[model samples]
Target chain A: MNDRIYMDNCVTSAMAPEVLEAMKPYFGEEFWYPGSFVSTGEASSAAFEGFREVIADALNAAPQEITFTSGGTIANNIALKGLALAHSGEGRHIICSTVDYPDLLTHAAYFEKMGFEVTYLEPDELGFVSAQKLKDAIRDDTILFMSTMVNHVVGTIQPIGEYSQVLAAANHKIWFHVDAGQAFGKLHLDVKALGMDTLSVSAHKIHGPQGIGALYVKKGSRLGAYIHGIKRFEGVQPGGLSLAAMAGFAKAVEIVYKDLDGSIKQLRELSDYLLEQLESQIEYVELNGPRGEGRACHNINVSLDFIEGEAITIMLDMHKITVATGSACASQGLKPSYVLLAMGKNQVQAHGSMKFTLSRYNTKEQIDFTVAKLKEIAAILRERSPLYNAIKKKQEK
Target chain B: MQYSEKVLQHFMHPQNVGEMENPDATATEGSPACGDQVTMYLKVDKENLIIEDVSFLSYGCASNIATASIITEMAKGKSLEEAKKITWRDAMEALDGLPPVKAHCSVLAADTLQTAISNYEIAHGLKEVPDFSKETIIGELKKIIYPQVGEDIITLKMVKYVGFEEKTGEVLIDLNLMSFDQYRDNVAEEIREHLQKYPEVKDIKINFPS
Candidate 1:
């Protein structure tokens, strides 16, 4: 009971002890801003570049191409707005999918309000915004196309390679930006192979400290200054980012990338076991996203029928288990998950949807315990549910 | 926002929960599509016109279950007239308080209780089936809480006008909510769900202060 089982890694995760250890010195006696002439400044500058290199190596990007930002949202803002402002003179049309992360969708809205034309492509039932749709939506005036590499809600991994080819085949240059906040450590990302003009990745998603993320800008690509301030770290979005967090971010990246495939496999196996246990123990459960390799490794979303999600989440919370739900009742705005809705789920399904994002820290025993408790909780909630009773009565007849 | 300790108590272990067999009257309110629904059962003492027993089954969130549990507790042993007088606010007060967003759950619970009582009265020939009119629409609208404030839209003066066409069964409402209001969609959705339950309402059109 003392150990809480946390499965909401998609939101955030427990920072690794090693990352904290790496960050301790930067927070203490060795703290110094990057500068020149002085030995302290030179040492700090060298350390900063080394940290940048670690993040760059994870994405197969050059160190100079990566700019450390405050977080994923900041990186997204800098990339999307900067790309739009830099290339707006050529065209004002932007393309994004309905099921993209809010970072990209909100930017699309802002671009629309700024008098730019936005084409919002709809995702398929499994939350796949196909590359063919991107190709079709492309126009001569399309200046930028934004996408989420891995959907934050359903974990559907978009075809970045195909998207890159589609944009490349276009007659004109259409700056491509990707919100890879969910994809950074969970999947293999190569900026050169993917050919995206700009991409954003966050550190906290991979057991790093919060408040630090990086943006990759392809060489020869120009970005208009979005954050105008003193030149500190990277000139792209000039501001003072936490040097200690950067060190921790690099350590987190190093640990994950040390055996990226092994880490992904571990997550996939845990999530698979979780899904299998849930299905075996529970009745009338339905998986919400892609079933196998098509989905990201860490996420397993499902909708349990005859009960609402908030009640189930609360019951699980009582047992010291944390999970996420798409229920409108649990949301601040009282709206169901837009990603679930856009994936063609009904209100009932969306309300019943539960998302379990596993990490390397999760275990088979934890999954089993979670499923067992969830089974009992589901039974209790169902017994108290009018919806379940109505359906049972119908089935009886 | 967090639920009160009392709310968590009732939600975790709700009282008078589950279906009641041989109920004198039963009524269901809200809808599955709206992410919440409650069914209430009542057993009234015909001679004394007192509610002998009351129970509820909810297909909603924690607050929804808590509100239903509290509403039943409040209605038990009370006269049918007294039970009908019980409002959502009283239930919220009894539960200490609910979050502003979850305040609508209390409304659903209380509405179901009142409807069950109304059903009992009509079945026992104590009252006639109420006529459906603009006033009925207004009464239903009063049950729709503006989640931002946990108050009825009518009480907040958010409902600028309400109109109903008797011949066409069309309901039209003009809300003072701005286009940018975060709760605008929620309010509109609740209004439609509330009115659409009435057989007289054929169509609903809600206009915001765009």
Candidate 2:
């Protein structure tokens, strides 16, 4: 139905057709080094910097403050490791949510290796880490605080603005970084508006080309470069940016937010329809993330009892529908999701977790097909589960 | 997960997916907490000591389901001795190949099969059943003493269960140890050496529950 339903947008979205068209000239006709002083090089650099201006304008920051990164993970690494190294003399303590993007948590481990202390804050039952928790965690030696604006697994929108306000009122000399990779295009993210000193966004998550992202490092923030190179990225990342990818990123940003209100409404309608159908038709299925406000408008995560998520994904994949499971089977570690565990879910419930992220291109028909297929698969799996049989026997008695 | 073609084929159409009502022996292994478990049901031939019918109900990834399906097919119509010898490697070979990480799924399936047979031996009390009682085994184990506990093994209550088959004289004792692991081998050897003197005890197995 409708050219193979794709519900894995949080993994990566399809490059927008308009973005591809905008990037064509940069790849073929204007394919010169952006660093040269010749006419062609000047033309290419001007076009590349013009896209950078689009990013700066969207985030309400100066052009110099925006640094083009390889992608979300690299952007996150630069923020966490970069700040940790630069501010080591000032302090050695850092704080972040346990359910933050893996790149952020991994860097926190690296910080620990370097003798820096890290505190991982657990989120509420609905996966919301409030500003009060962030406030209570601040210490005198706290050098940096980083958290994702929207969780990648559950899509629970954190209170980035209020958390930044708490840090501001405390007036502590801690650097604040927001991993806005999942929230930048969907949510109206302005670095100044959110009172955040630094933030990072990945372009591929919003229908832009892969391998391109941007990090807004506010003026006067001290950050040391981990990647040693000469003169490129002001020696921060020390590499050249892909001119075509940046052009596609800018064009995708424009296409997605062209009618921002309309696109958001569409996302909400599709998301709500899926949740409603699953709740009405399925038994023993529970939503893993929040429902209305504070939850992402285009994402839904659910956990079905007496079943496994990897089986569900594979069954759906056989039906030409794509989705993602957060089960240990889906992970390389062969253990349940640490994110779901941090959210207070037991291992069995966490093993049954599945995430569906809608895009601007998804439709109601696709969700209906997915929900219908899920009902059949869940029933079959439950029938074959000994735990399910025992529970049914007990209930019957 | 880079699953083998054989795994996908079996998972798509699992054989004997449900359980039997009051089968000869049924055992559940693994847990939902670990995301891999299977409960095997066996109907053994009372006269011949062969597994006549077998089925499984599992909760795990594709490998778990596929391994259960294949192991049950391999175990059915085979002697209890042959079935007990099926290893995780056999399950993987039967599956053609499995992802290296998912090798545990094969292990879980084979372990569950052995568990079902043990449960059969425990549940069945035939006319040919041995006269050995739980107290008799405990009395025999009392001959061995652990240095750390400074007492006979029975007083420590580490021996949780004892099952003996009359026809084969097979004895199984489950141990729940409270001491460190380094001394376990020595303690086990002393018990095995003591039990060996009884010619009626044809086979003996010492198992510790993790």
Candidate 3:
């Protein structure tokens, strides 16, 4: 097949066929606006309820607890800043990892600007954070602990479940939020089981329409104290909804959940085959994030030293393969990714990090072809690079 | 992302990359931490005010790396005065286009060219070249330590070398602790602070482990 081998799924995924089909009715037949209409309109409130049920089921939460937002960014903003603002009276301390998405950090900064103390914890070289370290950082003034389930750049899955236990031991009152845009559908997440108060997910990352996402708030949670919108999401998320996009998101989540085990296995196999192909062809390739079972199956952050990542990306594009250097949101930046830096990577390695994420549609042949093309381009670039040759010769001894 | 044909052309096949034999002036910039490095070599015809040759070695992102290579092509054969005036705007235009953020990299290209020209003048002794080498750096420290140990570079092996960057004229050194802990430990910092007192010394080379 001539399908373009896209490995930047962590940025945004292509809409699933099933998601498109489910959304078709909303764009055409049942196109009524959900806000002002009466009972007999072309679209009914039931449409939104249906979407809510699907998302709640996928999240293992009560349907009433799910609140829709524009995307992961907005969901994270509301969850983090809102919780901080609401609970500042109880405790002014907020803890976040230095490697978190800047959007979430920006929200934390808003809390800082509002007179709350914020601590940005740094991760280890493997991009893993210890629960003990987080507990040590926490104090009596700590009101919330926020982190990522999957780091957007390195794709290192954090021990959020373990951190949850640490938080519970300290005080059940501390709110925990996870930005799982890169991990939601790919990895298993059960909000209550993980002892999370707020969870952010994006439709685009899960093969649904773009610019649509949802946040999960546990039932009877006091998130209402932090929320400020025209209409209260039981006092937390206070915005109207995108019914059509939410419907598509709902369908996408349904499809993903229905085939979760099979899709996970397929993704694991595809990632394995691709990683093997890369390893066999490219010498001196350093895989970032975790070394084996500790990593997320969908993310493989590889650094081919001496060759710049932007160059590798362009050459791969020439081969009709799409991948990302660091997070898609941060790609426009010139500085090396802060996420990789927090993991103790020097500047060159951080700037050279590339994320390869696989979706359900990637085939084995495509992976092989991509590997062959990457090897050829890397070899050509290395031959022309004096830096690479110098480093190679020095290490040869 | 479709780059202009000019960008692709320059990126795919840049001209004047690598070294020149016995260059009159050389400049290296960028950091391995930042995932990019560039070294530029210049041969200036002093009598004619012409740049006889210019070459570069870059380890960086595709566009900047390519931009560095293309810069030499644009600069070659131009007068020293003309090459110094080459702005990042001109190079970006020559490449057809570069991302706005990478525009800073273009400035790095311009700065390297200027620094190379300046280094040429200094290396040729057309201007006063400052000496911040380990010998001179240690000489300054000996003046401070001579009062205590009465020993200098010729006498003792107290100095331990750490690291050095040749292009930027920067160096780091360490003075390993002997059996005694209080045997003049602030020599490194004292030397570093003293070196800043001299303007001609563009950078300080240090020795650590004391």
lDDT of 1 by residue, B79-153 (tens): 987888899999999999998878988899999999999999999999999999888988988998988889999
**All candidates: CA RMSD in angstroms?**
1.2, 9.3, 11.1
Question: Which structure is stronger by lDDT: 1 or 2?
Answer: 1
* lDDT by residue for model 1 (A217-323), tens: 99999989888888865623586777899999999999999999999999989988999999989998999989988899999999999899999999999999999
lDDT of 2 by residue, A1-397 (tens): 2588899999899888899999998779888756678898788778877888888888889888888888888888777778888889988889998999887888888888889899988899989999999899999899899998999988899998898888887756888999988897777777888888788988999899999898899998888886666544341256676789889988988877677778778898999999999999999989997888778888899999988888888888889999988887777555577888999999888999889999988988888899999999889888888889889999999
Deviation (Å) of A134 in candidate 3:
2.1
Better of 1 and 3 by TM-score: 1
Which candidate has the highest DockQ of all?
A: 1
Model 1 segments more than 4 A misplaced: none
Off by over 4 Å in 3: A1-3, A33-43, A225-240, A327-333, A392-397, B1-3, B20-25, B42-54, B78-89, B117-210
Tens digit per residue, CA lDDT, model 2, B9-47:
888788878989778998887788767679999999999
TM-scores for chain B, in order? 0.97, 0.60, 0.58
Task: Give the TM-scores of the predictions, in the order they appear.
Answer: 0.98, 0.85, 0.80
Clashing pairs in 2: B130-B166
* For model 1 chain A, the run of ten residues with the poorest summed lDDT: A232-241
Question: What order do you get sorting by DockQ, best first?
Answer: 1, 2, 3
